[model samples]
Target: MSTESVQGGGNDPAIEVTPEAAEEALSLLEGEELDTDEAGLRLFVQQGGCAGLSYGMRFDTEPEPDDLVVEHHGLRVFVDPASRNYIGGSKLDYESGLQAAGFHVENPNVVSECGCGESFRT
Candidate 1:
């Protein structure tokens, strides 16, 4: 595993990922052909979903200066500091089955989630 310090800007806060969560994210990326050479996951939070906040995840090659970069199991995960408050203690896991296969976040700050699981409210 590797670790990188993030440069701060604006109101960018600090975000941390647990070893278990990082490992799980890396395992899920294995065997998949990523479009980027960096081989890492980028996490972000957006607005306008049914629950007011939506989570986004993708494989990324570049990270913004204000992004918190965490590495585990040869994978790099990036998250903006502003989104940290909502997901600070969240656990990321890969779930696969007949219905769905994706990265799920167990965010403690999430008070309500939409039926489709695309968004949440704190």
Candidate 2:
């Protein structure tokens, strides 16, 4: 696992997750009965989507050498080095509503977001 600090004035360039987010994810895992013993989450950015960049998340048990690992509330979250620039200072949260529910990323680097909220331009 690797970690680096984003450089800027008056900005903390680190990914953060709220307690609600952690609990929500945990609840989802429990509902799915997914094996979380060695399971972890991975977040990355990919090209495509209306805004040129899209977010990706997955569950993993291993991390690559260049992955940036973040831990919160006993949960391990991994991010690829290349995607770090786009997700700097972002927050991960879980949301549930009558219409939709899932993990959401609040990114400071996002300049614009698509109507579907599946992608962003920065």
Candidate 3:
């Protein structure tokens, strides 16, 4: 229900962070005693999944020089150039339910995902 648009560092891909995700990420960052102004969630794609690519997320003290920086709802997200190719136009959301509760990336670039729903192929 919360709509928050991201401002990208360049004309590259843009990611939308839902209000829920922003709140949760900011809370986590604060819990870790990180600098909210500089620290951010690093989203990246790595090889190895059955579908050929898997998404990864972690907290970084700061973004790399070439990383794509985006800010939304007081939360900062950093994406490397290589990972941007697979996650552009994506929506980062947080889902809380009895079955699963976590940050999920609804990626538009995915053509198919593995049965487990952990990996995807473009």
Of the candidates shown, which would achieve the greatest lDDT relative to the real structure?
3
Worst 10 residues of 1 by lDDT: 6-15
Write down the TM-score of every candidate: 0.69, 0.79, 0.92
Best by TM-score: 3
Model 1: per-residue Cα lDDT at residue 52 = 98
Candidate 2, residue 111: Cα displacement in angstroms equals 0.7
lDDT of 1 at 88: 65
Which lDDT value does model 3 have at 58?
Answer: 97
Question: Over 4 Å off in model 3, which ranges?
Answer: 1-9
lDDT of 3 by residue, 18-103 (tens): 89999999999999999999899999999968999999999999989888888888888999989988998899999999998999
Q: For candidate 1, lDDT tens digit of each residue in 1-122?
A: 54544444334443455566566666556646553236578887888688899988877666777776655445577787777767765656666689876677778888899998889998
lDDT for residue 18 in candidate 3, whole number 0-100: 88
Estimate, for each residue in 1-122, the C-alpha lDDT of model 2 and write its tens digit: 23233222124266787777777766665676766555567878999998799999877765676677666775666777778889978999888899988889999889899998899998
| Alpha-carbon runs more than 4 Å astray in model 1 | 1-39
- Model 2 clash pairs? none
Q: Provide the global lDDT of candidate 2 against the true structure.
A: 0.75
